[model samples]
Target: MKQKAWAIHFIYAGIFLLLAGGQMYAVESFQLTPSATKFLAHNVGPGPDTPRGALNHLMVNSGADVRETIRPPGWIAWAALSAGAVMAAHGGLLIARKK
Candidate 1:
């Protein structure tokens, strides 16, 4: 029973570490600048300008602004990754202990 618990612990720890690593890497690689929107039209397409088109553009731009504002600091990512590593190590220790 103890061995089985330890094995499970190690498995969970490994998964956590993998997730943390990926998240940290993604944040590190992310750009702070907002990218150009390929889907949004600068002006009303072919037809006359309508309130709907203006509203759509406004919504898209606002969403982009929110995303840009909400990015986590690099240090935060490092801290999260560190926590994940610690959890993984603790789980490994559990696995190594005999019943």
Candidate 2:
């Protein structure tokens, strides 16, 4: 009975970690485009040079042209991969113990 309880606990923990890590990874990887810039420009009053501008000045060309991009650090991918691996290992151990 105790072993079964432990197995269930490990399984649940593994699933939760895997899902949370995946969500973090997805959020970090998502990127915005020029269309988003146009939408922001239309909805928002400020231009790219403004303090509240959505696009960075370095990437923006003049006040009318704005380009936005997102690039996640390699560490984020590594962390996600590590979390997934840990989850797989935990599940594998749980299954092995049952045998």
Candidate 3:
């Protein structure tokens, strides 16, 4: 029973890792700038679409203003990669341990 639950951890880790990996690959392979991130954050609204005139919201709190000349923050990719690694390691430990 517990082992089965541990297997589910692999699925969760794989999902997150795949998502972040895909994003990083897209950004690197396509040379995407911060503008793309801004567009997704503002229009696509990964968090929320409607603000309802609120001063502070998920979209508002997402990212810093991206200048046209500068590329997007590198930390975004690193953070995503780090998170995926941590999740993968956690899932791996859960699956490999006998106890």
Candidate 4:
């Protein structure tokens, strides 16, 4: 019973991850909200030399609309999708084995 429950949880989690991964994969880039931008600026600090720091500074300090853009690498999506598929498959196998 416990094993079956775990299997179900895994299946659900895998499906959610797969969906999120697909969404991330589909969207090439996304804009950061003002709050998110400010948060990043605080964390990233005010250094102007590095590209990330420059962007962060601009978004935080500039009065003009300076939305930060996030471009997730291709590997992350592929990895998430692969992991979700593997997890779902493993869960299915576990459930089958228990029966």
Candidate 5:
């Protein structure tokens, strides 16, 4: 009886994790739009002014490219999602056995 209960809980948690993990991965890509101008300015560095100039310099002129800052990476989210799926499977088996 207890194991069956656990299995149901695992399935629920797994579904939640899958949704949350996908959202997290998506948000990272969205950041580029909001930060575009600022990214160019900083990346181009001190010297020639203006956002347009900076953009042209960064993309068109392209003398020295700047490296983007790194994030903690999405592997953790992937891991969470994978674990959740396993838990759900195990839980499902338990639930099935109860019948």
Candidate 6:
């Protein structure tokens, strides 16, 4: 009974990690709309050449529909996917061994 519980826990953890990795992998690029830009500027505070200033500058100079493109690095997604796969496989092996 204790071993089964442990296996179940591992499986659940693996599933969560896998889902997170998949979501991370799916987003190659995204755009932040004008409103989102403004929100960020407000929260990020002001500076001459910082992110907040950049966002503010965009809001002031660009059209209302203009947006900022954000691209996260590829390695982060790959790392998550690799880690999640390893976790999930380890969990599956734990479950199988119990049975």
- Candidate 3 lDDT, tens digit per residue, 1-99? 777587667758766876876586557444336667455555554445346423224434557554233244667777767777777777777766745
Tens digits of per-residue lDDT for model 6, 3-77: 777767777777777787677689878788777866665565486388858767666456566565778787877
Query: Candidate 4 residues 1-99, lDDT tens each?
Result: 999999998998889879879988999998998777777777766667889788667657876665678999988888889889988998999999998
- Give each model a TM-score: 0.44, 0.41, 0.42, 0.76, 0.50, 0.53
Candidate 4 Cα errors over 4 Å, as ranges: 44-64
The parts of candidate 2 lying over 4 Å away from their true place are: 29-77
Model 3 spans > 4 angstroms off: 18-22, 25-72
Find the 10 residues in a row with the least total lDDT in model 2: 54-63
Cα RMSD for candidates in order: 9.2, 7.8, 9.1, 3.0, 10.1, 4.5
Q: Looking at model 3, how many pairs of residues clash? A: 0
**Lowest summed lDDT over 10 consecutive residues: which window, candidate 5?**
29-38
Candidate 5 lDDT, tens digit per residue, 1-99? Answer: 777777888899988887767776665643343255345555655544777565555653464434344354678678867877787788788788889
TM-score of 4: 0.76
Over the full model, what C-alpha lDDT does candidate 1 score relative to the true structure? Answer: 0.59
Q: How far is candidate 5 from the true structure (C-alpha RMSD, Å)?
A: 10.1
Residue pairs clashing in model 5 are 7-91
Task: Using lDDT, rank the candidates from best to worst.
Answer: 4, 6, 5, 2, 3, 1
Span of ten consecutive residues with least summed lDDT in model 3: 52-61
Report residue 49 deviation for candidate 5 (angstroms): 38
- Better by TM-score, candidate 6 or 4: 4
Predicted structure 1, TM vs. truth: 0.44
Task: At residue 90, give the lDDT of candidate 3.
Answer: 72
Number of clashes found in candidate 6 = 0
| lDDT tens per residue, model 2, 63-87 | 5556555567767756766776676
Screening candidate 2 with a backbone cut-off below 3 angstroms (N, C-alpha, C), the clashing residue pairs are none
